[model samples]
Target: MAETILVTGATGTVGSELVRALINRGVNTRAAVHSIIKGDRLRHFNPEVQLVEVDYHRPASLPLAFTGVDRVFLLTPFSDQQLIINQQLVDAAKAAGVQQVVRLSAAGADMEPGIQLGRWHRQMEQYLEQSGLSHVILRPTSFMQNFVNYQGQSIREQGAIYLPLGEGRMSYIDAFDIAEVAAAILTDDVAKHHGQAYTLTGPQAVNHTEIAGIIGQATGRPVQYVDVPETAARQAMQGAPQWMVDSMMELNALGKAGHLAGTTPAVEQLTGRPPRSFQEFAQEHRHELMPA
Candidate 1:
């Protein structure tokens, strides 16, 4: 019998792509989503793929999802309660005797102890290390999908990309590459990637100005990068929790200081292919960037 792999956050950017990659390779995959309603995206892969509603907050929902599962791709939503939710998955995975866990972490999670996001990921990494299950920690840099998720409408309507990252170079990675790497590790021998942490990145680091220029070239329209002041950025996020807003500002500050500009060969090392550049990402998603 083939080994079963459970993928948490199956409906998300990386998770959805990871599931597709695993299925493409003929892996017996189980996609754990929060609701059956959200499983619509994965419906095309029915029969070949199993969709299970696994709620991290509800401990009872996990064990059934883990049944017969040999490996797990653990991805927790971003929130103040991340630690609790991650712990719940770890404990359940331990109880289920899952052979391995591939966790989606963030860049600088181990190096920068001050950033709240990194700190949370680091905490989860430490817990997984002690969980006694073989694991792979993927620390990918900021995703290129952020443009489509948070600023696509602005880019289409106003031809502007606004952020608090002031002239700082960032190695924004494509989530597709991250998902490919995750699929590779999960499908390969556990011993080959176990107890390892991979800092995944794009081919090069580019500032917001360069990013805007790339989009402009791809869409044949001039797109501008608006560098907002920290105060203004904070005000824009008025209704969000104070801690979350402060974290975003601090992360942007770190980027502006050029701390997030590093690139790595991890993506190529795992997938045996060069990571996609921002220009390539823009061209591929041109329809989303171009105005209707």
Candidate 2:
């Protein structure tokens, strides 16, 4: 029988794609979602994907979620209790006889406290490292799908993309590529994979204005880029909590000053394919942005 790998945050961007890649390689995937309602789509996406209710906030669900699972992919919704939730996952993974674990962390996942996600993810990485399970930490840069969130309702009405990030360059990585890398690490046992973290980014660096230009051209619409102040950016975000506001602003400030603009071939090296360019991403989803 094939080993079963349990994936947390199964309905999320990377988790959704990660599950597919694992199943393609003949790995049995069990998706631990917060609720059965969210797991329906993942089950439809993969016949082999088994959905189970595993709420991280309530650590009680984790043991049941990890039952008979050999490998685990952990993802914490970045927030105040991230460290605590991650610790719970580590304990549960260890208790449930899990052998390998993969973590989806943010860029700059080091112990240093320069960035919020960095500090939190580093703590989680350290906990998993000493948890007696083989682990791979994926520190991916700014997600390109963050742009997709803007296209949802407000930006479609306003014909513009708003951000606190001015003309700062960043290698915005594709979430699918991140997932592909995560899937590879979870399945294989390369020496370099253990006790190591990989920083994943796109092939090239570009600014928010350039992203706007791509979106404008791709959709044949007049799209504008407006650099709002951090205060305004926070107010503009719908349903954004106070913590998310702080993190988003910090990331924007960091990117605007060119602090997160590292290009890498690691994604391609691990996945055996180049990360998707903004042009390709735009072309594939142009219809969604410009529905007539």
Candidate 3:
């Protein structure tokens, strides 16, 4: 029998890509999505995919999603209740006899006195470690897709990228690359990756100014990076909740401090190929980042 795998956050960025990768490899894939409707994209990719509705608020749905799963790809969304949801999933996976799990974490999750985001991920990592089930943790830096997802509009309209990151560089990885690494480990020998944590990143570190230049070349436009004041950044996010605003500012501080600027070869070591570069990502997403 082929190995059966269940993916949480199946409709998300990395989760969606992982589902596609697993299907391509002919692995039996069950995608745990927030709604059956959201699984349409997965079905569009491969009609054979098994879709299960999983809502952490609805605790009973947890075990059913894990039933008969050989391995799991766990991704809890970044929210106030992230820890609680991950704990619930771990307990459910344990009860359902899951053989292993590949968890999505952040870079710097293990750092001493890190930011709230790192602290949150570290807490979950610890819980999974103590759970006794075989596990592989993937701690990836910021995604290159953030340009299209978060800053696309400004790049398109104003021909400028605005952030408080200053001259700090970050080795942002493509979510697709992260998914590829996850698929490789999930489908390969479990023993090799068991109890291991990998920090995934792109091949090089780059600052926002360099990122702006790349985007300009990719989109055939003139784009510049604007280093705004922290107060101005805070004001830009005024409509969001106070906690979320503070959280973003904390990450901004880390970026400005060059704390997020680091490169790793784990992606190449695990997948037998180098991670995607920001230039490639910008080119691929050129249409999305082009002028509106």
Clashes of each: 0, 0, 0
lDDT of 3 by residue, 1-292 (tens): 7889999999988999999999999999999998898687899779999999998899899978998999999999878999999999999999999999999999999998988888999999999999999999999999998888899999999999999999998899999999999999999888999999999999998999999999999999999999999989999998898878988899889988888888889999988889999999999999999876
Question: Over the stretch 1-292, how does candidate 2's per-residue lDDT look in tens digits?
Answer: 7789999888887888888888788788899888888788886666767989987767888889999999899998766888899899889998988888888888877735677757767778888888878888889998888777655453467768877888999999888899889888887874558787888999889987888889889988878888888777777785878777777777778899998998878988998999999888878777777744
- Note the Cα lDDT for every prediction shown: 0.92, 0.83, 0.93
Q: Give me the displacement of residue 30 in model 2, in angstroms.
A: 0.2
User: On residues 109-222, what C-alpha lDDT tens digit does candidate 1 reach at each position?
Assistant: 998456988888999999999999999999999999999889899999999999999999999999999999999999999999999999999999999999999999999999
- As for candidate 1, its clashing pairs are none
* TM-score of every candidate: 0.98, 0.94, 0.98
Task: Flag the better candidate by TM-score, 1 or 2.
Answer: 1
**What is the Å distance of residue 62 in model 1 from its true position?**
0.7
Model 2: residues with Cα > 4 Å off, grouped in runs = 190-192, 237-240
TM-score, cand. 2 vs. native: 0.94
lDDT for model 3 comes to 0.93
Please give the lDDT score at residue 52 for candidate 3.
Answer: 97
